[model samples]
Target chain A: MPKGVPERGSIPDDGLTTRQRRQQPVLAIHTGTGKGKSTAAFGMAMRAWNQGFDIGVFQFVKSAKWRVGEETALRALGDAHLASGIGGPVEWHKMGEGWSWIRKHGDDADHAEAAREGWAEIARRLASERHRFYLLDEFTYPLKWGWIEVSEVVEALRARPGNQHVVITGRDAPPELIAAADLVTEMTKIKHPMDAGRKGQRGIEW
Target chain B: MPKGVPERGSIPDDGLTTRQRRQQPVLAIHTGTGKGKSTAAFGMAMRAWNQGFDIGVFQFVKSAKWRVGEETALRALGDAHLASGIGGPVEWHKMGEGWSWIRKHGDDADHAEAAREGWAEIARRLASERHRFYLLDEFTYPLKWGWIEVSEVVEALRARPGNQHVVITGRDAPPELIAAADLVTEMTKIKHPMDAGRKGQRGIEW
Candidate 1:
């Protein structure tokens, strides 16, 4: 167990029984200036996928052109499940304005609209319980930039039905969103390769 | 890209060319009061596995009996790679004193000795470059607790030959170790399920 983490039995009473607590879904936030925020969320998604949790990943900042290693692996896992009926469904959606968006729309308004559309889709999924695990990668940026309302996002998450687990990853996550989350991890940066004049490498960064 | 991360072209010069910088190995430290430190390392291992980099994992705190989901997945990948010759070799070693060790040794001296042995084995591997990527999971505790000398570790890592990338995970990592590392990410806890009176659940923690 990690240091400073209280044992389950030792945790102070919150007026909830073990069964009641077990039934509660997690709203985890991964926000910080360091690396691994998104990677860590992807790791959890992998575990959830292993447990037959239908997973939905909505990317907010990353471009559609950049294919991350996790996406490739998880998509393959989802395909294998489709072929052999072993695991769960996995869907990935990229909401950022990449080169394609620039070529087509060439406006910031289009990017903002894309972000809003992504959140609406997620809201719909949450209402219908379409996915057991939802990863809102870099979703905090849109809220910070005022493209999405923090209140609406919080309300949707709080009212999200069933046992759906949601994970949000980004830097500078709003105080309201952090308050709404059950679990939040801030990745503090002590050092980075770029500090030593190195660029992000394939496999390590992607 | 993550907020505040310098783009490749914008990275400041550190007197090394791109090729020279790429050749240098990375010594990354993941530490702090939050979860996903180890999970993030496991994700990197997954990426390395995909790139066919020979990987070695040494767990210092977690027991051999505790089967983490990442271990299961990576081991499965390793097995598949071995069967198909698609990837590189993968080795995992647990050096912690589990239930059996407590039953037999039942002393701090034994635990300290085990930590020393684990470090010695890793040092030997570093010298020979047995693995391209080495994950020393939960290794910070030994240094913090004085079971292993931080200076010796720093020296070994500094002198470690080849382009071997090392990632160490645990909380309260020593300042000396952090200073020696090329990249350090501190996982700060903003909130947790345990804070909400929830225990570690399957497909989330393990």
Candidate 2:
């Protein structure tokens, strides 16, 4: 076994060739208790965009006011794409706007409706092959909170059309989602600055 | 503690306002045995780029032939900055060339000089504040293999001038580096498709 590459036994004898495997859709989940789950998803989207993949970012964070720096850069990239054919198209949606937890925290009725609607829209898009690359940013929250159906989401992803690549990021990803994902990485906090009384900063946090 | 934010006890008696705290420089590390260590760092670079930070990415991986997608995308962004001034200036350096491990393995005499020269260059840049944001991608390898002095690197980082932010990514990060860092995240592999015989693919892996 080479440094990072696993042993031959790790290769489960899948019948597909390497080229065929390359063409397959990837379902990746970035979930854990540390940072960079969403950041890494955005990074992957940047790479996919460079590969001429239509990028669709659906941010489902709990806070509607939490507009991060990636949004600004990605939106700029989207504009640049529209103006000149440099990279692929980019679409960013703040899915938490309608039923934000910061606005209505304990009320499952309001938040659940928004979450289901968001998931329903994603399902429709998956079925129609709207985006070549999909980033469900902070999407695990809805699934974890029971606002969205895990089984239905998994089913839609399983049956998604075309070679669309989906990357979902958040903490506490459902076990079933993990099972369905092609790649799942847990961002463990080794050491954080906030431990030394550091609050979140503007550019880094947002 | 609200969801992700630490509790009140996590906030020490440090008497600095949030604005003042935001002005401080950050030293981050992304290290573990899983993927996305470099990807997440690139993602953070994009955000910093959006914030108009001069970006410098120095890749010190063993394999010189390995050109990832972030390189292309970031170079484009850098070019875009040069042409239209949308973002900040970006400099991407493949520091692993010349003395690549894939080219010359277990030959310390050939590789050690390049590694030391790379570290020296980075130290000079840190002292001069060459870039507002620096991504030292796969930097831990040299330290782990004793190609670069960990104590010297830490000293340079500590003595870095101005508000230069640094992010180093790789596996097997030194304890001294971790101790000196403001933020550190370990990418733990929960599940991977390569485990099921799916080899690395284009557009996703790159």
Candidate 3:
């Protein structure tokens, strides 16, 4: 056997009878304080979709403020599969007289329930191999903050099919979540204008 | 303190206190089997130079076949700093001329040493905080094959001043490197046509 070549027994059935399986849909989580966690996943989703892959995204923490950017872009590809949890009927917070808005309609409990529903949908698609790329945007932070349980989330993900790649983004991700991942990134905060009370740029933030 | 406020005391009083630090340059690496690593890095270099950041690029593991398309595009931006490992010397492989086009030039030990000079120049700019962005192309695959020590690379990185953002891309990165990374990703190969005998695409692959 040549060096760096895998043994015969380990080959995946995807046509290469060698020990290598075609790369499974990766499971990744993006966490920490740096900007661009979700943006990075959005870039990957776009690239993967360009190469012919279906995608699903759920924005867990976002209420009405969550504009459908990634979803819109994915749909532009024309082969994408889309689903989301909208910010129910209430306004959670108001910035002046509608100059700004937050999830005022739903309380933490409502958000948690919406997130659970969203996760169930994501897990269902993963199990059936319905999509090549699945993104649970800001899914774990609510769970980490005690709005959702780790057990419920883990059970759903453990049953995910081998062919689906799931991407989660948030801050303060739990340890068990990191352990189960094939890839994880912690975006360390180095510097930002937010610390100086400067507001975020429109296109850059939100 | 509110939850998730970037832990205090993470920033140092070095020259990178503000985004205005002239000498603190961005560090980037493009490594992996897939094409576009160099192209992506070049895009960032151009973006930074256009924004008035002095840019330096260390071309490791590249051969004379590494043609720079769009010379006119680059010539329009006159202030960019450009350097290459090969000044004009053309080396042929013993197996044949055809292999030279496909083989990674830096994977070989002797050619890897050839890049040491270019990297040193990049290092000088990093230390002096002279440039705004330094792109180290194909840096880690050689490290993976033991052509370069990871610690030596880390030392060179630590020598860089504050507020520098480094992007390194490679397949099968070491755990130590992952731990040190602020952002990391694994480009799992799910459906590549190369497995079915399809050739690379121009403008996209090359």
Candidate 4:
């Protein structure tokens, strides 16, 4: 046998490799017209927190009253915060009225500005290893529409602290991001409640 | 067999059965004489948060200066508040004066009362479904010691608003409480620095 020969079913023993501690945590988000993208991001956050990593989350589209599991669960995570819409959907109908929930319809520049500010907040948090995860909810749509600069986001990821994990989500992700991510998932829409003529189910889909 | 009967090995109809939704959310904390209990609790918190649910948590047993992931992560959560150490441990501890670490030398009643107050705060959150998850850190040991009333706890669980989850943790969980719980996990101790002649690892165990 050679010095580094391997058996058919088993390789020669090289002793158990010591676990390399994780470095440069993670920066990922799901984008595309699909469902469950946010769910996927939050799942990762949960896993990271279990390992004693800090986490932060921001939701662009949801209102304070539209409470869901992750938002509620995060309240217990001593340092986590979520700034979101206040009451109703922040969509095309509710353009900016100076309320956080307003969508600022058709105003690409305005939307882009808001997104930029959100990213800036995220960047500040990401600079600290004290908080390891930052989630930007519904971030890609603004980025895709030229409301936010994709290059700025790339820079943010590059500059993130060694132990930080960042996640962003929205429809229509830039191709450059897809090529650069450690993990990427696409939540394709097979069917949805609105399609079935049903409002969002409280405590379930919302 | 009757004609048109479903054949064996054929797939059963895959549809959700119409059962009453689990109105009482399950609360679980992975705590014991070992570490990682807080980390596990934080994981559940993150899971609940991503779903956009409202939640409340009270940190008992640990000091304000003894900041960790929960303290750091929840800072962004906005709604979260930390009322730090009540000057006790899950079990008896011996600490030198002027420090807040767990002490076997502290008065039992002081510890018990502090834990009771914590439970009351959790119960207050449970009264409204606005916060879907309520966490009481290091709660069970005090309960087991008769610091908090079992009847009151049972009543609180029964009175909890719909879909609210409550999590409590500590060493030596009572058998009666375990039997009543929707989910209970015992974190068995396998190894520890205390046994290995090393202090708890910073950021890993503490």
True contacts kept of each: 0.43, 0.53, 0.00, 0.08
- Candidate 3, position A80, lDDT: 17
For model 3, residues B1-206, the per-residue Cα lDDT tens digits are 01223344443455343334323333333333433344434444333443434444444544423323212123223311233221111121211112233445444446555545445555665677655445555566667877677777777776678545455555556656655543343332223334333232221122
Question: Which consecutive 10 residues in model 4 chain B have the weakest lDDT in total?
Answer: B86-95
The models' CA-based lDDT, in order, is 0.78, 0.79, 0.46, 0.49
Task: Give the alpha carbon lDDT tens digit for every residue of A1-206 in model 4.
Answer: 01112213342243422122223344554654544456546544544453555555666642434324565544443233223321111111111222233344334346556566666656666666546566677767767777667887787787765656666776777877665554454544323323322233333343
Better of 1 and 3 by DockQ: 1
Report the C-alpha lDDT of model 4 over B114-148, residue by residue, as the tens digit: 66655665566567554676666666656777878
Alpha-carbon error at A74 in model 2, in Å? 1.8
What is the C-alpha lDDT profile of model 1 across A5-121, one tens digit per residue? 554557556787666666678899999888889878887877777667898988886464333667765675566457656556788877654322224644445777778878888
Q: Identify the leading candidate in terms of lDDT.
A: 2
Model 3 lDDT at residue B103? 47
Model 3, C-alpha of B199: deviation from truth (Å): 22
DockQ of 1: 0.39
Q: What would the per-residue lDDT of candidate 1 be over residues B1-206, giving only the tens digit for each residue? A: 53335544575657776667556788989898788898788778777776688999998874643336666556655765676665556788777543222245444347778888789989998999999999999899989899999999999999999889999999999999998988899998877778645766556665
Q: Per-residue lDDT for A1-206 in model 2, tens only?
A: 11336434554566776678778899999998888888888888878877778998887865644445677677767766777787788887765555322354344447677778778888988999999899998888888888888999999999998899999999899999998999999999888777776766545555
Using TM-score as the measure, which candidate wins?
2
Give the poorly placed runs of model 2, Cα more than 4 Å off: A1-12, A62-67, A98-109, B1-10, B62-67, B98-109
Chain A: TM-score in each candidate? Answer: 0.87, 0.87, 0.70, 0.68
Model 4 misses residue B201 by how many Å?
2.3
How close is chain B to the truth by TM-score, in each candidate? 0.87, 0.88, 0.61, 0.67
